[model samples]
Target: MYETYTTVIGTVVSDPRHRQTSTGEPVISFRVACNSRRIDKRTQEWIDGPTLYLTVSCWRRLLTGVSQAVAKGRPVIAHGQIKTNEYVTADGERRADLEMTATAVGLDLSRCVVSFEGAPGREPSVAGTTTRPVGSEVEGAGADAQTPTAA
Candidate 1:
């Protein structure tokens, strides 16, 4: 089976919701809104573009950290398998929503600062040396649970 993957860079529009799947697996879900803004030379003002909103779901290991790190209006970058969820509404109208089951979600560093905190009992990397490939900590704590302090 083919799966579609996408990365979204945007602001979290809602608080993360912690819920369980029918099978009792923990899942964290939130909404992200992506938009662009540019300064107009003529008016010397900012011009905002249309916004795209997608519901993002984090599962298993991803649940703990995301539930702690993000809140409404926080910037984040989420990458995952993309799908369109279609269902009938209570009003008897059919609706479709864009959703992503996130494989990874993190703060948008370009918009805010981040401080790295290793999980307990993990050794720190030696200066001027690499212990592992960047992003190899997927199996460990991906978001580090601790809220980042902006500089």
Candidate 2:
């Protein structure tokens, strides 16, 4: 079997909708919008490229993490297998949508600061942890926030 995999960096455009299938398996789905920007050499100005919207689905084990970490308006990075779904609207309009079955999804740290969450059913602590200021944070970021560096 052949599958197309891709990574998308974008903002979560809707709240994740979660439900259990008839067979009792858990699943979650959400929408993401990716807007790109580039600098044009001719005018020396930034240009906004067309935005790509996609629906993302995650199954079973991924549901918990996504439920805890993902939400509307949050920046997220999703890696998954992609497919194009074509359909006809009620008014006889044709449409195509990009959909992905995610293998991995997480916060986009480049755009925001976040606290490390403890695993499900566990207490969060910073015992014996090392931390350092991230020099790449946007100017005017709060002084007290710092990302954990891998040991």
What are the per-residue Cα lDDT tens digits for candidate 1 across 32-127? Answer: 999999999999999999999999999987776676566677678999999999999999999999999999998776676454444468853222
Candidate 1 segments exceeding 4 Å error: 119-151
TM-scores for all candidates: the values are 0.75, 0.74
What is candidate 2's local distance difference test score? 0.80
The lDDT for every candidate, in the order shown, is 0.76, 0.80
Best by lDDT: 2
How far in Å is the alpha carbon of 17 misplaced in model 1?
0.4
Residue pairs in candidate 1 whose N, alpha carbon or C atoms collide under 3 angstroms:
none
Model 2 weakest 10-residue run by lDDT? 125-134
lDDT by residue (tens digit), candidate 2, 130-151: 2332344545646444454421
